[model samples]
Target: MVTIRLARFGTKKRPYYHVVVTDSENPRDGRFLEQVGTYDPAKPIESARIDLSRVDHWVGVGAQTSTRVRHVLNDYRRATQAIA
Candidate 1:
């Protein structure tokens, strides 16, 4: 099954992630089909970015999002809503 998830990267003690679509059988940081966005815990909440359009597309096509990624997307929505 194809799923939307995070791919871990960055040096030890400093973590970064790419929100990607990949097969469920693949390893956490293994091969991915396409990157849709990024998550950097080190960055401020207001600065974190995601492409909701592509996310909607992937989910529409049957991509399931990870729990953490779902939270991040929610945060993005709330932040943007507050600004508008």
Candidate 2:
């Protein structure tokens, strides 16, 4: 099954995440099909960036999103809309 989730990267104490699409059986930071967004906890919430068009396309193709990814997507959407 294909799934949408975060892939951890960055320094030991400084964490960064790439929202990616991959197989359900794959390891957390293993190979991913595509990167759709990014999350940097140290940055301001509004600074987080996401590619909603790609995300929507993936969802339409039956990709399932993790709970945390869903929350991040929601916040990103709201933030982008507010600035537009």
Candidate 3:
């Protein structure tokens, strides 16, 4: 199953993540098909960057989002909405 999830990166203590499309069997931070976004917990939640168009395309093609990704997407959506 293809899934949309976060791949951990950055140095120890300082964490960063790439929102990627990959097979469910793949290990976290392992090989991935594509990176659709980025998350830096050190920054504000609104600062997370995601390509919503790509995300929608992936979702349309049956990609399931991880819980944390879903939460980030929701917060991003709210932030964008508020700015508009």
- The list of candidate 2 runs beyond 4 A from truth reads none
lDDT by residue (18-74, candidate 1, tens digit) is: 888999999999989989888898886568778889999989998898898888889
Which candidate would rank higher by lDDT, 1 or 3?
Answer: 3
Q: Which ten residues in a row have the lowest lDDT in candidate 2?
A: 41-50
What ordering of candidates by lDDT runs from best to worst? 3, 2, 1
Which digits, one per residue and each the tens of the lDDT, describe model 3 over residues 1-84? 999999999999999999999999999989999999999989987888899999999999999999999999999899888988
Clashes of each: 0, 0, 0
lDDT of every predicted structure (CA atoms): 0.88, 0.92, 0.94
Model 2 scores a TM of 0.95
Q: RMSD (Cα, Å) of candidate 2?
A: 0.8
Whole-structure CA lDDT of model 3: 0.94
What's the true lDDT of residue 76 in model 3?
A: 89
Off by over 4 Å in 1: none
